[model samples]
Target: METDNKESIIDYQYKALKDGKSIRLLYLHTSSSYHQLPIEVSLCEFPIDACPSFGALSYAWSIDDDPAPSDRELLCDGASIKITKNCEAALKRLRRPKQDQILWVDAVCINQADLEERSLQVRLMRQIYTQASWVALWVGDASTAVDEESGLPLSDLGMDFIHDFAVEIAERTNSGQALNEGPLYQEFIKDRRAFQYSESEVFAPRVRGVWDVFHRNWWKRLWVIQEVALATDPTLLCGLKAETFHNLKIVIKALIRSEQPVDVMEFNSLFIAHTFHQFHVRHMIETGTMGKISPPGIKALDILNATRNTQASDPRDKIYGILGFFGPPATDTENIFPDPDYTKPAAELYADVSRAIILNTKNLDVLSSCYGFFKSTVPDLPSWVASWNDTPVQYFDGKIFNAAGSSTVVYEDCGDKLLMRIKGRHVDSVKLAGQIPDSIGYSNEACIELWRYWWKFASTLDSYPTGETVTDVFKDTLCWGSHLDYSRQQLGENKESFNAWLEILTGTDDTDIAAKRIFNDGEPFKYAHRATSVTWGRNMSITNKGYLAMVPIITKADDKIVIFQGSKLPFIVRTEDGTSKLGGPCYVRGMMDGEFATEEDAGAMDELEWFTLK
Candidate 1:
């Protein structure tokens, strides 16, 4: 009987969801030890809006490219199935020892093999999670290694430090010892008497714990942004220990406010998590509105851009996962695409999303976000489509430029879904392109050498087309015509800062001396980093019309610069096969602000030239 049962090969089959609003919940049986007990669960269906009290699991499906083996078998009802090591770990940790634990685990609840069912289930995720009693954010296992110096678990030390840091902040704020709450003005908290740890003291283990906590795989997942944001209450689970999401958020906010020692956007998972918590969730909860007044409301394009650097198992989830934040597409007019259709290819879905955003926003500002034109992984993706896969080197301010004036996108679809046609005015063609530095923000000498090379190249031009001195145009072009401060004002009156930074970079004999000086004087390095960062993945190019401009790294001499009807900035387009392929967006000195298209000509749609993008 045992041999017959073993050879039976029982397979778990999912019954179709009763309706569009229906979802599955798993009842995980109790276990004393994960190693000793077989993981068993039973699935039941219910309407999401009226489902029984259950905790939702929000976790990373796979931690890395070569994830641990999925050799563990899960018993569901009378059948056995395979589950990812990460998912299995989460379930094992989540299972209660006393009684059955009900959960809405996506991997177990949803029938992933069925594409139609997957799409429907994805659409209902917002409801599923929002209605759940609590959200368990499983951030993998806690480190068991004890810090020899501190005599504490490495991961626990990190959480304790964060809690203590928050306590210090509250005590200081209440006592009126407020510090400047900005990344630039990070004055150290000298009052370490409470924590009894000094900046110079032997507290390396504590710092390591802080880094480990923030750099978890769970924080970087794309779906967690919505999962945690929409959850009524969220509990961050790491192996046996747990903490509230609110506390974790306080830690992140405190770091941003007065404690970040490094680039939070680079080292810490700042933008996606912070933006979702402080901006998206806060606005909705405070105002009872879907959008915000100061930073604008939740828009599809904005959401996509915010989470572009986040990871997803399916390329399509890059868009689908974010849809739950706003209203449903069938009802909300602002929603870009229809329901999440897994049947569509990723390239096709991305292209369609691009078109929908352009049409919905009535502007080609989305085109400026298209970094995928050159390096997209999606095969046969349209040049006009933004892949939303990776973050752009620098984000162009949507309100800064209006090369095409106050005009809306004039889209002309020629019955072919893949082909996109738009109208634009020919601005200029590239004449001479200067090489961008191979290494930026690393070596002071390399940046100085490259800047000097650029200055020498600028000297070759007889005169500036914008009527400004070549010196001024060249300086402004390096930072893309805007001041690099928090205000982001135009670079017209900030020449002294640029000159002062350059003097420090060039006036020194040793690069080490320059580096030390810049480090000592923070303002100078701020200017230098901003200048180099914007021009890192780009080059300075002299236009055929004798304009100093910034173009893509792939740009060459004779590449056409064109301003689309609704584009805030001009784009570099390379003509091939009688069609245009976008080289990427550019900054043409003197042509950024409605200089190419006058108000009168821009309004006259018939006067513009139309080009098709393949």
Candidate 2:
């Protein structure tokens, strides 16, 4: 009788595999023991075209470095297999007390030890998560104790505050009321009053609590991007508490619209929140939630850019993990996106993916993400292929933020090897590079030192005529060829526009007082700090032809600033021997927004040369 029962269970499980409609679902049986539990794994076979209702588990693998062996026994077909402690915990928490619970967990469902099986299942990951009833995002056990950094408790109370804040803001947003006049603001004001007894004492802890949750390692996982984005309904599970992705998104949107002043900690939390919201928006567009009229699909390059910092166990998954979101409708004959292959090496895979995106998109924007010697930490890869494993350079999102105008160019794939040929203007070379000034300090002396460097550099620029004094040249350098003034020009004449520009650059309309304090007396120029503090990508460099230009902060003295035809901003290139290295995107003051592609500039392109990036 015992042998018959075992064989019967095996036959039932094997039937699903035979039909090629098999998926292993963990059936957690209720246990009276609080800590020890048994999980029954049953192979369920649905029709090949149809899937049954099951919640997919999206979670980080472990909390520590040591890979703990599967300690708990999971019964499958009357046989037992070991399961990890984390998995056991998840199953126990997710399981119902009286009824059996079925879940599709990657660790157990897929044969991870087999490479071919891993690759095949990864290809099916999109379908697995999408077809599931819902996705449970396990963010680990919740902590009510205060976080050391944010000084806020990681408990249900904090989640409640965030949810309430989101609810109030959503109501107002739906009603189309301005964010300032909305109930969100009113609630904020009330909180501020209640906490006024200790300005730093009260809000700091709460802000920190939000910060702690936002910075959770779960957000950094590459696979979670698709798991959450593709889910029909996703729930964030932190310990015993739960929150919907929809509510979190609402709170994120409200926080983005808020103009309230916050300390660095609050700002960091808000930045992460904004990034998450942006990811969701992009995910929606890619998944066709934005409708058919939206762009046919998202490029692999864009997906990579958005999720560059997302962590993965295998470095190759950095590219493979997000590949499912690319390409056309499932029914389309030709799939432009490269299929995930775990066998490929990280560098080679990244290079091939880069080539594929450029070939399919027919745009050189991918090249803009390639970093130069100074910018790139990866030395082995060729200069042309972007370091997919590296964190994306700050402020260069591959957008044409500062291009004078647009142009088209041809891309030559140069066979299967990682080499490409492009034709564009070489422009000018870098002669002198200065260290990016230190953070604008609170003391007056720091401002004076910064102003002195600016004065020396501005004096070299052709934009500042010879007759003008150092002071005059400094002002001209700030105002001349500024895109910020273009909108102000519609309101008034040149003099009015100049004053507006002066006010912006100096942070005050009283330019004379600001200038005198800096140039004449060498005192602390209150507005001088704005130059360094206001924006990123403002490292000062002198061109070989004696032009002072603002290049990417990673700019070196020998780096070449080249303006590729289709690119919006000038690029910093580092040349070693005969080959060239792209140092990523850059912002050169006057060359932004197609200014470089103006009629006169276009005509000057007759001297275009062949530039080979290795």
Candidate 3:
């Protein structure tokens, strides 16, 4: 890449974590290598297990035993990394010296070389950096550090919006006292049945009701649900029409001088994230945030119309307005990558396999190695994500939108590796975690056709095998925010019959046959252990999991509300223990039970069998 311009060298060793454990990382001051095309850094012949206490004091490597030799470590694929001029100044800076440096990027590491290996590393990534002597977080929260005014990464941050908004709202307005008790009150209490609430009542002030009329968890709902509305008119955001705006002005002012504020940022990030997530969520809803118009997201052109009716003070803009504050969209995780279109039929069935593998920075070194294989073999990925001129570790799956306003990613464990079936366009998928599919071993053609189904499906929002339409998917999962990236995973209905149908549709054999046998004729999808079941006209089963999208979300009797229905997946009946078992998320009202998408797609399910990482 670029030649070293700084006169000083950053030779360091033996870094220790807060827990006082020795950690190994090639922490060289490659500040001078910014934007340089290609450069090399000498790594010891093998990975170092332990780092030294202090680096650059003197010659560290034993010259007699070194195999890489000086200046012969590993060559970086792109960019020269710049370090801070002073230790304090550099404390927050993140730089990638080279792609192939003994240690390069946490995002691109393909650590799951084996199933056991993957299991061991995922749980450790959270610890490795959290305990690092000093984790050089990039400009974003993923690896280096969270940044300000940066584009939001779709993978992890979006979830923060839904979960945080839910938690925040749940903390407020969850009481049986009902929000309509009076005009919007400044303080509120938790409802015993709230998502995260416990027997002990949790209360807090600074909360407001969704409306003076309903008094729902307006503020507590995913920020995305109301962000667009708020953005249109922040004033409306505070009343019965909208929800409470935890402007956080009071708390922020209080934190002006406290160290706890920085730590507190993590807890409030959901608010920041809802700014964007809310937009994606509402964009798909038919209700249109009260009076706002909804845009049919068929093409990129829809964005223009969406903007026209966009609430003036929309939270989406507010979230993006402070983009740089969260650092980069992704940190240690592979925050950027190719996205499959989730709007189609094939993707509805085949599932997003390649995406599931690269979820987190389980093992930086290992994941990076897997990325190398992708660049070498796949050869053609999206231009922005190409290997040569890119940041290491920049891809993730988990963005899919159903018409009724729902989104989520599906993950499947394919033996040694985790397959994240995603909704994308160009590159269907790229496997990671040191584990490659045996199916991939056969021929790239199988992989190509497999992805072709996904590609065509996501490219268009029709024919999703769900026996439900985009509108149906959106209704149940409206709170789930699906961004433009089309990243998605684990699609077929979670029930066993649909799993079998997915196998037939994808041209992939059913690896889970024992599960297939559970479903009998006269059942939905004619397969097993399903808790719900339904059939269309003429004795035909609607549980085909063939990716044929459900149709006619508009009810014949009315247009304002969709006609509700049920599926044959399994029994929602309660056990003797008084608990109900079901797969996927559902809405239970008195005796009215229906399977639908959640506002946010965090893979909500009533039981382990209902959802599978595999």
Candidate 4:
């Protein structure tokens, strides 16, 4: 007979494994009882190849820092150990009523108390998931309440809507009505009867059900990307309902492509889902399983940028969690990255990875990722090193600019490991920085006031440099010369869109009427979105040289703008105590495409000054 008493039980201890090839598996005993029953599991060691069939479990340890206390007990190997509320919920749902279930759960299978064992187990994570029979992705328990009309559990209703949405999308795409061919979400919103959605609003019960499903914490964790991508087959579980990962991927990709009713948080979920889907697709393309052309290979920089919003209990996992996407190194010694070492400090690990990415890519695009310096939380981090643990700041694509022209990066030999010395040309100083409004896109009146202020600021200049009207330059600067899709374009299209949008904004004194006109129009809010996206965390400013540009919010009145060798975008550096500290990357309108290198300054690219960044 088994009993569940905390005082009478001893905590389970983890046994050491033989080698890197060895792993532990949990065999959960079955019982015909509710989820409240005590969890009984036994762990056994086996070589990865020789282990019994098992399903890999992917889940978040806790959604937030203040997780519920670990009061639930798990009876393991005739002893007992406490587990998180989330882990207990997942195991209770996973256990079958008959026979036994074998699972490879990270929390239970790996010895968390032993740092060495953790590092070794993390190294085997890729192989463990890939070799498993299937991967069980547990989002969390569903709401216990049933829908009033449908009598279905809230999670079940949501999953039903999601499954049906995927089927409809697949059918439409196959029938030549590809949802991605154009603005499908907008069209869908217009014709609700076509998709069988009610004519009332976008957030009907079923539609909101879909939203709630994507909003789960499982979608936001950094580790699930590798787990789902590596699994041969993965099933998503919420309470008692289940869905194939394939179906869920379909809806997620569709949602991201359409950018429909989903807001920022939901969009992040879509991003995570899209990222792992791309990872799996890339693998299939490489194995020749999918006979189709593949997109550009994913790089370390791309992974870092994509997962910036994701969270990790340990900051070191921010770098270590995604290493599985890079496949095994040819040999242990030749590996581009050292094995995940839990012993190193988070800042040191971040610095090592930052250096490796620069050496591997041979570019400074990664430096742009060092944007959150003003609000960074990482201690002892170099000014140039990116703190991936912070909230993601504005990201400017370096590929769109050639600010430094054709010069390649010239690395200087710096004695200190924390300092990076580079050659750059000091372009200009910020003469005046405009106010960064908190309500640019969200408030119509606020947008109009801010726009009026910026227009007045631009009028202070006598004339423009590029031979264009002040109107065109001001509008282009507002949108960063990019369209709604973030594709860089010439002056005509964005200028027209901004003009039409401004006409409505200024046409009426009543903001409600103006806002309605803007929103009620076809593909409304496009111009405002394009502008706010560029200006959200940035400041519009005029340089001492009369160049109109957008710099990071951290840019001050006297901050110096410099174009570094081999860097596509210009850098803003603040001087203190005779040494320079990086403010962040910026966008100078005329200087983006080698316009800084004029015909008058012969060999200007060769005459770069050295600045040591601390």
Write down the lDDT of every candidate, Cα atoms only.
Answer: 0.72, 0.58, 0.25, 0.71
Which parts of model 2 are misplaced by more than 4 Å? 1-22, 38-40, 43-48, 63-86, 144-153, 170-208, 258-279, 286-298, 327-335, 374-379, 396-405, 436-455, 460-538, 552-554, 593-606
Regarding lDDT, does 1 or 2 come out ahead? 1
C-alpha displacement of 466 in model 2, angstroms? 14
Per-residue error (Å), model 3, residue 500:
50
Model 3 C-alpha lDDT per residue in residues 1-614, reported as the tens digit of each score: 44455444343221123232222344333545444422333322212235432121001121112221233222322322332122112221233443222332221121212333322233333233223332221111221212133443321332233234444434444553422232222122122123122321132212211111112122222212322332322211111112222332222222222333222332233223323333443334334432222221111112212232222122222212221111122442222221222232222211222232223311111111122212322223321111221222222211122222222322344442222222211101111111123333322233333323432433354544445554334222211211112233232333354444334434543434322332223232332111111111001012223222211111111111111111111111111232211111111111112233223323533212222122
10-32: candidate 1 lDDT, tens digit per residue: 77888899888999999999877
Model 3 residue-pair collision total: 142
Top-TM-score structure, candidate number: 1
- Most lDDT-accurate candidate: 1
lDDT measured at residue 56 in model 2 versus the true structure, 0 to 100: 90
> What are the RMSD figures for all models against the true structure?
4.8, 7.5, 24.0, 4.8
lDDT of predicted model 2: 0.58
| lDDT comparing candidate 1 with the true structure | 0.72
**Residue 489 lDDT in candidate 3:** 21
TM-score of 3: 0.22
How many residue-pair clashes does candidate 4 contain?
Answer: 0
Q: In model 2, what lDDT does residue 229 have?
A: 78
**lDDT (tens digit, per residue) of candidate 4 on 494-602:** 5556777777755645766666566443344667666756666767789998888777876889999988776778888887886788888887678888876422244
lDDT of 2 by residue, 1-614 (tens): 01123232221222224333445566656654445445555656444246656789987666443445765556676766556766666776687757766678887776666676576667667677778888898766666566576654555545666677677777777888666565534443434433423432354445445545665567777788888877877887766777887787776656544355433224434346524733564456656654332222234555677777777777788777875564333753224445667777666776777666665554567766576544444445777687767765443234525362556544555564656566566667788876655564424444334445555666556552234344443443333223221221111223433443344344542444444444321223222323333234445667776556655566788787777765656778876776676776664444555655533255565756556677
